[model samples]
Structures are given as structure tokens and as C-alpha cells.
Target: MKTNGKKTGSGRIAYRKRDRVAYLYLLPWLIGLVMLQFFPFFSSLYYSFTDYKVTGGMNWIGLDNYIRLFTKDADFHNSLKVTVLYTLYTVPLKLTMALAIAMFLNRDIKGINLIRTLYYIPSLFGGSVAIAVLWKLMFLDNGVINAMLTALHLPNIQFWGDHRYALKTICSLEIWQFGSSMVMFLAALKNVPKELYEAADIDGSGKIAKFIHVTLPQISPIIFFTLIMQTIQALQNFTSAFVITNGGPLKSTYVLGMMLYKEGFAYFNMGYASSISWVIFAMIVVVTLLLFRSSSAWVFYEDEEK
Candidate 1:
């Protein structure tokens, strides 16, 4: 019995030794994440507290940035409001459209390989500088959109000329780039247990019922992930706003990102830009946390305790 106990202890030690070796293999990634990701995160926190201008040294400014933003800066509030509006509109529309389209494509169809490539093409060009420039031309007052309207006997539409509808064109552009999220939803959909869907169908459930009862629950985690990502992407959007209206008509589409760019790079006011960036970061953090909090009611897992 003593010898058997000795053997058991040796086996336990060997297992721990194997785990230590496995973790050692992950050491490089751990170090890189801490140095590159974690360090920069805390550094941004420090930068937010100081008045760091591109032309001048980072001066210690305690609460001045936040104070000015709330009390004196109208543009800051306007930008924040615009960003929130854009995030709320873009995230849901984009992800829902992506999932709907992905569900259609999830079936085994003829030329599905070609179809996937075609769908994926937009996401590849979505963030490119050239594509943004092209989008600007497409949305110009007398551009193709207006040409089509005129052909149908409708008055010529002004995409950027009108303040109210100007942001809609930008939102449309953001929604058009739904391919990335669609692909993710597609993968998650494929992994959903076919048995659950079969069981639903056997009960005479229709397509919509099957989707609600079986598909959505299984892929809810991916939907949540894409929702958070798309929200962040839309909130921090700069290129579309920059290229399309140049925050124009009258700063109508001046999102927080565009404001950050104008303040930091154009005016060489790094201190103010850093403040704006910090505000954006805080807003994103808060909204994301709220989503997480809400997810407790909706987001499910195979393991309930998880």
C-alpha cells in the first residue's frame, strides 16, 4: 500500500510537470500580450490625464480635459451624440443583415464556393482608402444614385448636400460592409447541432420557427460577439465620414473619430485629441459593459453556470 501511494504521488507530479511544460510553450504569447496590449492600454489611461500636445511636452492637467468637455465643449457633446447614434444604427442593422444573408448562403447550393468569394470581396475592400474615395464619388450630388432617381422620374437626390439624409448614406456604406460579420455567423451556424434543428423540423416547425427555436440559441454567442465588435467599429468610424462628407454640410456627420483626427493631426492639438480619444474609449467601455450586463438575460451557453 505504501508503494502504491508513492506511485500515485509520482504520477500526480508528472502531470503537473507536463502542465508546466505546456504553459512554457505559451510564455511568448503571454509576454507579447502584456507588453504590446496591456502596456499600451494603461499608457493610454495616463495619456488621457495629461495635456499632451504634438508640438509641446505633455503637461499635467488634472481634470481639465473632462471639465472642458462637459462644460465648455459643444462639439465634443455633438460628436459623442453622433457616434452613439451611428453605433446603435450600424451595429444592429449590419449584424442582422449579415446573419440573414449568411443563413441563406449556409445551404449547400450550386457554386457556393464562388458565392462565398463574392460575398467576402466587400469586407476586403471595406476599409481601404481607395474604396472610401470611390464611395465619395458614388455619393456625390450628381452621382449614380441620383442618376437612377432621375430616370425613375424622381427628383435628383442629394446624398451629401442634405444634412439630415447625409448621415444615412454613410450608414448605408457601413451596412454594406457586413461581409466579415456574415462569415463569422456562417461558421457558427454550421457548427450548430444538426440534431436540434432536425428535432424542431420533426415537430412540424417552419423555417422561422426552426431558426428561432434552434439556430439562434446555438449561435447566440457569435451574434453577441459580432454585435460588440460592429458597435465598436461604428463608434470609432473615421474613414467613411472623412472620405464621404469630410464631416460636412455643417459638421453634421462629425463623429468622435473625425473630431479626434481634426484636433490632433490637422490642428496639431494632441492634448485635446487625446482627451477626445479618452472620452471615446470611456464611452465604448461603458456601452460594451452595458451589453455584457444585458447579456446575462439573453446570452446563453451549453453550460448554464458558465
Candidate 2:
């Protein structure tokens, strides 16, 4: 059939028409990308180079905000230390636990879907204010965790109260969201060939041996991807620290995100906050590139199957 002098699907015209319809359907997303994401990106770049405040006019200040952060700001140093520590600790622990749990559940088990749902429940509220506030209660002096310690005849630990363990409390909140990462790893693990494991078994490989020889190699790409992603997420983490600790115990848990918020919202220093955001963006980019550079040594693909 032809209309308005247009050709039919027998020609390349039909594919182009389908593409146009697909683009049309994607028009809303394109608009939102430009409006919500693209515009803010450029705006942030501009703001980072200026002396803009939340309630004041913008004045171009070049790299002064960046300079102040590195050289003149003690609090920036503190926040950076806390954030780096948090990221380092949380990422590996979460990934390891998640991978372990996912591998365990990957077997032939009844109600696996239900178990998955149960595991994933914490992820749904990982960043919610309500959950973080509730976390504050959970880490209190007489909370569930401490009560368990007491029952075990160990000293009741003060989690969020002390500078020593406040970071640990926040990490638990971060690690609890491992379900999302676990679900991804589970899917990737399932995609690993059963033939590979069978072959390993024929070679007299035990469970641990098969896991090291077949499973780790197959899942390395997913592991690397989640590592970079979770690092980025943890670097920009705000709500948990904000709600649970409020950067408490001498700002021992103050992440860069909290510093940005305090500078922009609390102190009306938008330019400094924007500068901080850009620094974070650059840090994430650098870390991601480093991981990508190192991935060729470890991350395996079937295309490069060896």
C-alpha cells in the first residue's frame, strides 16, 4: 500500500519510517535529557567557574573555588578522607557479600523468586529519608544490633554514637542495598555457560576450583562494571550520612556530598558547591577510566574467549 506518494516495505522506505516512529516515541526522553540533564550540566560548568551564591549574583572567579577546596579548606580535607574511606570499605564488602549470596541462590531451589524479592526489599528504600532516619534508630545504643551483641555476651557496641564506628553504621546502610547489584550479578552469572563448568568438572575440578576457573572469569566484566558504578554511587552518597549521623562526632562521617550541601544550602555558596560537584565528576571519571584501563587484564568476554 502507498499513501502520499510514499513507497512500501518492499523498499528501504519502510525501515526508515519505523525508525522515524521510534524516534518520535523517544521524543519525550530527548526533551527531558536536554531540559533536565544537558542544561544542568552546562549550567554547572558555568557555575563552577564563577562566584555564584544561592541568593547572590554570579561573578566569574575562574579556578578560585577549586583552589580554595584543595589549599584553603580544612573541612574539604576531612570530608574527602571520610568519603574515600567509606567508598573503599563499602564497595568491596557489598560486592563480595552480594556475589556470594547470588551464587548461592543461583541453584535449583524452590521459591527462589520469593527469596530474591525478600533480598531486594532493602534496595527499594536504600536512599529514602525514612529508611535513613530509621537506620539512626537501628544503630542506637540499645538497638537491634547492639542487643544482639549483648545476647552474644559481647560488649554492646555503640555504632553511630562514636567516631570509631559511625562510619561502620553508615556502611551497613550502604551495603544493605547490595541486592540490586546482586540481582545484576545473578543474571550475568546465569549467562555463564553450563558447558564450561561441566568441562571443568570432567577435569576433576571441585566446586571452588570450578568457581575460580570458570565462574570468576565469566563474571569479571559484570564485577568490574558494578565496581565502577557502585564507586560512583558511594562517592555521591548523601542521605545516609545526612540522616543518620549529620556528619556527626566531629564531622568524622562528612562525605563530600554533605559538604556540598552545607556550602550551597546552609551557607549559600553555590559556586563552591558546583565546583565540588565538578571535582566529584572528575574524580569519578578518573576512577572509571582507571578501572577500564585495568579491566583488559581481568574482564573476560566470550568474543575474546580463551
Candidate 3:
């Protein structure tokens, strides 16, 4: 009994020593999470309530910044409206184009891999500053696009200068990068059971009917995921608006991101910018919650049916 007790005690000590080593390995990540991510995240929240400046130090201001945003900020209202319009235009169009292209590419054809790689190239480089600059140049009055128009005897368009086309042009830049969403949809499509399509055909279902019933229900989960992701992305759009139009000829493409940038860096209203960031965060949270709530109605799970 004495020897057994000694062995047990030594085993406990060894276990503890192993645990300590494991914790030592995790320490760096824990420190990074606390100092880099969590610290900055919560600090921004606290800063939102104060009159924080880059160099003037923090001053407690309560809800004055938020009050101004709700009551007197015309630019805020315009930015919000433009952002909603941009989201409305981009999300559905991008998803539809992605799904359609994905369906087309879900076949056994020669050079299909090369075609998919070609399509996905845009997504790989779409969000870069270079792509935004290229988009800007393409739409310029005397740019390649206009040169093509000249060949066809069509008039040149002031794409960047005109309010009517500025936001739309930016939306086109976003929609042009549907390759990522297309890949997701393609993966989902490939996973769909061939038996289901066979069953639909046996029921005398047409192509459209099979798509509506079999394809849509099977792929609804991917649709839901992409919908949420794309919506969040659209809400926080910045690169295209900033680099392409610079908030535009008349602030027509001024999204919340541009507004946040201008307030935070350009004007040095750090407190107000923090508030805007929090607002953007809240909007994302609320929108995400709503999507979750709505998912049950449309998103299909094969396990649930089983």
C-alpha cells in the first residue's frame, strides 16, 4: 500500500508538470489575444463614449457624439442611405451571378479547371488598390472604355464625375468579384446527391422544377451563409468607394467606411469615428441576428429531415 501511494503521488506530479508545459505553450497566444485583439476591441467601445482625440487625451462626453449623428448629421444620413443602396444592389446581384456561373461550371468539360481558375482570378485580386485604380482608369472619360465607345460611335461617359453612374460603377466593381461566392456555390452544387435529381426526373419534373425543388433546397444552407457574408461585406464597403470615386463627385458613393475614415483620420474626430465604428459593429450584429432568425425558414438541413 505504501509503494502504491508513492506511485500515485509521483503520477499526479508528472501530470501537473505536463499541464504546466501545455499552458506555457498557450501563453503567447493568450497574451496576443488579450493585448492585441481584446484590448483594442474593448478600448474602442470605451472610447466611443468619450471625446477621445489622437493627441488631446480622452474627455468624457456621454452621448453627445451619437446625438449629433442622429439629429444633425446630414452626411451621416446620406452615407447611411448610400450604403443601403449599395448593399441592395450588390448582394443579390453578386449572389445570383455567382450561383448562375457556378451552375454553368458544374459540368464535365475540357479546360473546365482553367476556366474556373480564370474566373477565380478576379476574386484573388479584386479588393486590391491596384484593381480599384484599374477600375477608375477604365471608366475615365478618355479611358479604354470610352475609346471602345468611340469605335462604336457612342458618346463618352463621365463615369466618375456623374452622380448617376458613380455609385453604379462602384457596385459593378464589387459584383465583378463574385468568384469566391461562385466557388462556394459550386462546392455546394457538387455535394448535392445525383439521386435527388433522378427522383425529380422520375416525377416528370422539368429542369426549372428540379432546380426550384431539388437544387435550391439542397443548396439553401450555402445560400444562407453566402447571403450573411455578402451582406456584411456590402455594409462595410470601402475600397471601391474610396479608391475609385473618393466618395465621389457629390458624395454619391460615400459609404459608412469612407465616412469613418474621413472622421477618424482626415478630420481627427477620433471619438466620433469610434462611435461610427461601434455603430457599424452594431449594424453587423443586428443584421447577423436577423439573418439567423430568418435562416430557419429557408435554410435546409438534410439531418433535420432525417
Candidate 4:
């Protein structure tokens, strides 16, 4: 009995030593989470409840900023409208284009890898300031697009200077960066079983029929993932509008992100900006929840089949 008790004690000591080593390994990550992610998260929440400024002290203000946002801020309303419009225009078009290209790339064709790489290059630089600046230059009144139109005896279009075309120009930029979604779709497409297609063919299923009945069902989960990710991305888009249009042309391209930036940095309304940030966070959470709720009806999992 004494020997057995000693053995058990030693085993527990060894287990504790192992646990200590594991905790040591996890220490850096825990530190980073608390310092970088969690601190900012809770700090923003606290800031939202105070009248914080960039260079001055803060006083407790409760829900005043949030109330002002809904009641008095016309710019907030306009920015929200523009953001919703941008998301509505950009997300579906981007996903559709990505899926179409993914389908094309899924075909067993020569030089397909090279073509895929070429197509994917735009996404690598899509969110960069340089690309936004380049896009701005390209859409200028006498820029390449307009010059080509002029050469073809077509009238010049003010892509950046005109409100009608400014937002659409930004949407086109977003759509052009569909490579990430395309690659994901391509991966999902390849996972679809060849036997399914063969069986469908035997059952007199045409190309469209096979796609609808087989390909779509197999890739629906990926589609759902891309939809949620792209929606979140579209809502948080700021770099292009800031670098390209500066939310100009009558603020037609002003998005919620830009509003957040202006309120936080430009105006030094940190408390109000914190409130906006929380609102954006809440919006994202609600949208994500809605997607998750709807996903059960559409998104198929391998485990579900079992």
C-alpha cells in the first residue's frame, strides 16, 4: 500500500510537470491575446461609454454617442446607405464571377495552372494603397479607359469625378479581386466525386443538370463560407474609398468604415468612433448569425450524409 501510494504521487507529479511545460508553450499566445486582441476589445467597449478624445481626458457619457448616431448624424445614415449599396452590388457580382472562373479553371485544359496564377495575381494586391491609387489614375477623365473610348470615337466618361460612376468604379475594383473566392471554389469543385458526374451522365443529365444537381450541392458549403466572408469584407472596406475617391463625388462612395475613420482619426471623436465600431461589430455579428441560421437549409456537411 505504501509503494502504491508513492507511485501514484510520482505519477501525479509527472503529470503536473507536463502540464507546466504545456502552459509554458502556451504563454506567448496567451500574452498576445490579452495584450493585442482582448485588451483592445474591452478597451473599445469602455471607450464607447465615455466621452474620450484623442489628446484629452475622458468623462462618462453613457449612451449619448449612440443616441446621437441614430438621431442626429446624417453622415452616418448616408455612409450606411452607401455601404449597404456597395455590399449589395459587389458581393453577388464578385462571387458569381469567381464561381464562373472557378468552373472554367476546373476544366482539364492546357496551361491552366499558368492561367490561374495570372488571374490570382490581382487579389494579392487588391487591398493595397498602391493598387487603389493605380485604379484612381486608370479611371481619371483622360486615363487609359477614357483614352481607349476616345480612340474608338466614344465619349469620355468621368469615372472618378462623377457620382454616378464613382461607386460603380469601386465595385468593379472589388469584383476584380475575386481570385481568393475563385481559388476556394476551385478546391471545392475538385473535391466533388467523379463518380457522381458519371452517374448523372448515365442518367441522361446534361451539363446544366449535372451542375445543378451534383456540383452545386457539393460546393454549397464553400459558397456559404465565401458569402459570409465576402459580406464581412465588403462592410469593412475603407482603403479603396479613402485612397481612390476620398469619399468624394458628393460622398457617394462613403462607406461605414470611412465614417469610422473620419470620426476616430480626423475628428478625434474617439468615444463616438468606439460607438460606431461597436455598431459595426454588432452588425457583423447579426449578419453572421443570420447566415448561420440560414445555412442549415442549404449548407451540406459530410457528417450530415452519415
Candidate 5:
């Protein structure tokens, strides 16, 4: 018994040494998380309460910034409203297009892989500065689209110049990048059991019936996930608004992200910017929570059925 006790003690010491080595190996990641992620995250939260200018030092301001944003700042109100509208316009339309294309591509046809690759190519560069620039150029007064319109004897459209069309143009750019969502939808569609469709057919269900009763229930979880993700992405959209319209035509495209950028970098209102960032963060959290709350009603799981 004495010998066994000694052996156990020695084993415990060896384990401690191994754990120390493992901790040493994790040092870099720990340091990075502290300095790069956590520190910045908390610091922004703190800064949001202060009047911290980029050039001028931080000064404590309580809830003045938030109060101003809610009441006094019409620009903030407009930006928030525009952002919400943009999110509403983009997410559903984009997801619908994605699901449609995914359904079309979900086949055992030849060269389908090549076709998918071609379709996915747009999403790869859709959010890029170059693509935004190209979109801008293509929508200009004397651009390719207008040229085509002229050939058809139609009057030129002011896509970027007109406030009514500017936001829609940006929404179209976002919708055009439906390839990623389509791929996800395609994967989800493939995973749905063929047995379900066969059972539906045995019940004399038509294509539409099978789709509604069979396919949608099976793919509901993926749809829910995509909806949440796409909503978040649409809320944070900046590159298209900045590079294409620059929130132009009477600030029609002035989204929350562009507002944040202007507040932070352009105007050097670091504290105000941090507050805006937190507001955006809060909005995302609330939206995500609402989705999760609503998900129980719609999102289906195979395990739940089991």
C-alpha cells in the first residue's frame, strides 16, 4: 500500500508537468485573445460611455451620447430606419432567390458541377471593392446598362443619382450574391430523405404538395440558420453603400455601417462611434434573440421527430 501511494503521487506530479507544458503551448493564443479580441471588445463598451475623440482624450459623458442618438440626432434616426429597410429588402429576397436557384440546381444532370461553379463565382467577388466599382460604372448615366437601354429606345435611368432607385440598386447588388446561400440550400436539400418524397407520392401528393409538406419541413433548420446569418450580414453591409453610392442622393443609402464609418473615421467622433457600434451590437443581439425565440415554432429537427 505504501509503494502504491508513492506511485500515484509520482503519476500526479507527471500529469502536472504535462499540463504546464500544454499551458505553455497555449500562451500565444491566450495573449492574442486578451490583447486583440477581449481587450478591444470591453474597451469599446467602456469608451461608448465617454466623450472620446480620436485626437482629443476621453471624457466621461454618462448616457448623453445614447440620449442624443435617440432624441436629437435626426441623421442617426434616418440611418437606423434606412438600415432596417435595407435588411428587410435584402434578406428575404436574397434567400428566396438562393433557394430557387438551389432547387433548380439540385439535379442529377450532366455538367451540373461546372454549372454550380459558374453560378458560385459571383458570390466569391460580390462584396469586393472592384465589383462595387464595376457595379457603379455599369449603372452610371452613360454606362453599359444605359447603352443597352438606349439601344432599346428607352430613356436612361439614374440608378445612383435618383434617391428612389439608389437604395434598390444597392439591394440588387446584395441579391446578386445569392450563390453562397444557394450552395448552403443545395446541401440542405440534398440531405433531405428521398423516402419522404416517395411517401408523399404514395399519398397522391403532387410536386407542390411534396415540396410544402416534405421538403420545407426537412430543410427548415437550414432556412432558419440562413435567415439569421443573412440578416446579420445585411445589417453590417458597408462596402457596397460606400464604394457604389457613398450613401448619396439625399442620404438614401445611408446605412448603419456607413454611419458608423463616418462617425468613427471621417468625423473623428470615437466615443460617438463606439456608442453606435454598441447600438448596432445591441440590435443584432435583439434580432438574433427574437429569431431564436420564434425558431421553436418553425425550425424542424430530425432528432426532435425521433
Candidate 6:
């Protein structure tokens, strides 16, 4: 009994020592979470309720910032409208183009790896300020696109200069970065069982029919994931609008992110900007929840089948 007790005590000491080592390894991450993530998260929430200025003091103002945003701020409503419209236009267009290109690239062919790499290159630089600036220059009066049009004896279109085309130009810029989505779709496509396609072939299914019946259902989960991600990204888009149009020919491209930047840094309305940030966060959460709720009707899982 004495020996057994000693063994048990040794085991407990070993377990405690292992736990201490594990915690030591986790210490840096915990410190970072507290200092960087958790602190800012709660501080932002507190700031939202106060008239916090960057230069100096803050006074508790309750929900005045949020209330004013909804009621008094016309830019808030316009930014919301533009954000929703941008999400609606860009997400679908980008995902459709991605899936289509993914399908084409999924086939076994020569130089296919090089083709995939080339297609994926755009996504790497898609959100960079430099890319946004280059895009703006390319859409300018005598830029590459207009130059090509002129060379073809076609009238040049004012891409970023006109209000009607400004938002669409940004959408096009986003859709051009469909490489990430394409890569995801291609991966999902590769995971789909070949037996399913063989069975569809046996049934004399057409290409479209096979895709609709076999391919889509199998990859529905990935599609749902991409849709949710792209929607959030579109809502948070800032660079293109900031660099290309500076929120407009007529505030037509002023997304929520751009508005938030202008409010926080440009205008130095820190408290109001915090409120706007919270609103944007809430909107993202609500939309994500809605998408998750709707996903049950479409998204398929192998585990669910099992």
C-alpha cells in the first residue's frame, strides 16, 4: 500500500509537471490574446458607448452614437446601401466565375498546373493598395482598357469617373480576384468520388445534368463556405473604393469599411466610428447566422450521410 501510494504521488507530480510545460508553451499566445485581441475587443465596445475623442477625454453618452448613426447620418444609410449592393453583385459574380473556371481547370490536361498557378496569382495581390492603384490607372481615360477600346475603333468608357459605372468597376475588380475561390472549388471538385460521375455517365446524363445532380450536391458545403466568406469580404471592401474612386463619383462606391475609415481617421470621430464598427460587426454576424440557417437546405456533409 505504501509503494502504491508513492507511485500514485509520482504520477500526479508527473502530470502536474507536464501541464506546467504545456502552459509555458501557451503563455505567449495567452499574453497576445489578452493584450492585442481581448483588450481591443472590449475597449472598442466601451468606446462605442462614450464620446471618446482621439486627442483627449471621453464622456459616457449611452447609445447616442448608434442612435445618431441611424437617424441623423445620411452617409451611414448610403454606405449601408452601397455595401449591400456591392455584396449582392460581387459575391455571386465572383463565385460563379470561380466555379466555372474551377470546373474547366479540373480536367486533366497539359500545362494544367501552370494554368492553375497563373489563375491563382491574382488573389495573392487582390487586396493590396498597389493592385487597387494599378486598377484605377488601368481604368483611367487613356489607360490600357480604354486604349484597347480605342484601338478597336470602339468608344472608350469612363470606368471610375462615371457614377453609374463606378460601383460596377469595383465589382469587376473583386471578381477578377476569383482565384482563391477557384482553387477552393477545384479542391472540392477533386474530392468528389469519380464513381458518382461514372454512374451519371451510365445513366446517359448530359454534362449540365451531371453537374447539377452529382457535382453540385457533393460540393455544396464548399460553395456555402465560399459564399459566406465572399459576402463578408465584399461587405468589408475598402481598398478599391478608396484608391479607385475615393468613395465615389457621387458616393456610389462608399462601402461600410470606407465609411468607417473616414469616420475614425479622416474625421477623427472615434466614438462614432466605434459604433459604426460594432454595427458592421453585428451585420456580419447576422448575415452569417442567416446563411448558416439556410445552409441546412443545401449544404451536404459526408458525416451527415453516415
TM-scores for every predicted model: 0.86, 0.90, 0.90, 0.92, 0.91, 0.91
Which 10-residue span in candidate 6 carries the lowest summed lDDT? 1-10
Candidate 6 Cα misplacement greater than 4 A, ranges: 1-17
The whole-model lDDT of each prediction reads: 0.84, 0.90, 0.91, 0.92, 0.91, 0.91
CA lDDT of 48 in candidate 2?
Answer: 93
For candidate 1, what is the TM-score?
0.86
In candidate 6, which residue pairs clash? none
Please list the residue runs of candidate 3 whose C-alpha ends up more than 4 Å from where it truly belongs after superposition: 1-25
Per-residue lDDT tens digits of candidate 1, residues 137-249?
A: 88788888788888999988678888887787888888888888988988998899888888887899998899887888888898888888777778799988997788886
Locate the minimum summed-lDDT window of 10 residues in model 1. 1-10
lDDT of 3 at 286: 92
Best by TM-score: 4
Model 4 per-residue lDDT at 131: 90
Give one digit per residue, the lDDT tens place, for model 5 in 113-206: 7888888888999689999999999999889999999999999999999998999989988899899899899999999988888899899999
Question: Residue 145, candidate 5: how far off, in angstroms?
Answer: 1.3
lDDT of 4 by residue, 190-254 (tens): 99999999999899999999989999989999999999999999999999999999998899998
Candidate 5, superposed: residue stretches over 4 Å from native? 1-26
Q: Which ten residues in a row have the lowest lDDT in candidate 4?
A: 1-10
Candidate 2 backbone overlaps, count: 0
Better of 4 and 6 by lDDT: 4
Q: What does candidate 3's lDDT look like per residue over 92-201, in tens digits?
A: 99999999999999988899878888998889985799999999999999899989999999988888999999999889989999999999999999999999999998
Residue-level lDDT of model 2, residues 1-306, one tens digit each, is 654544565656766666678778899999999999999999999999999987889999999999999999999999989989999999999999999999999999999889999999999997999999888887799898789888999998778779998988899888988999899989998998899988997899998999888999999989998999899999999998988889987898999999989988999899999999998899899999999999998888888846
RMSD of 2: 3.9
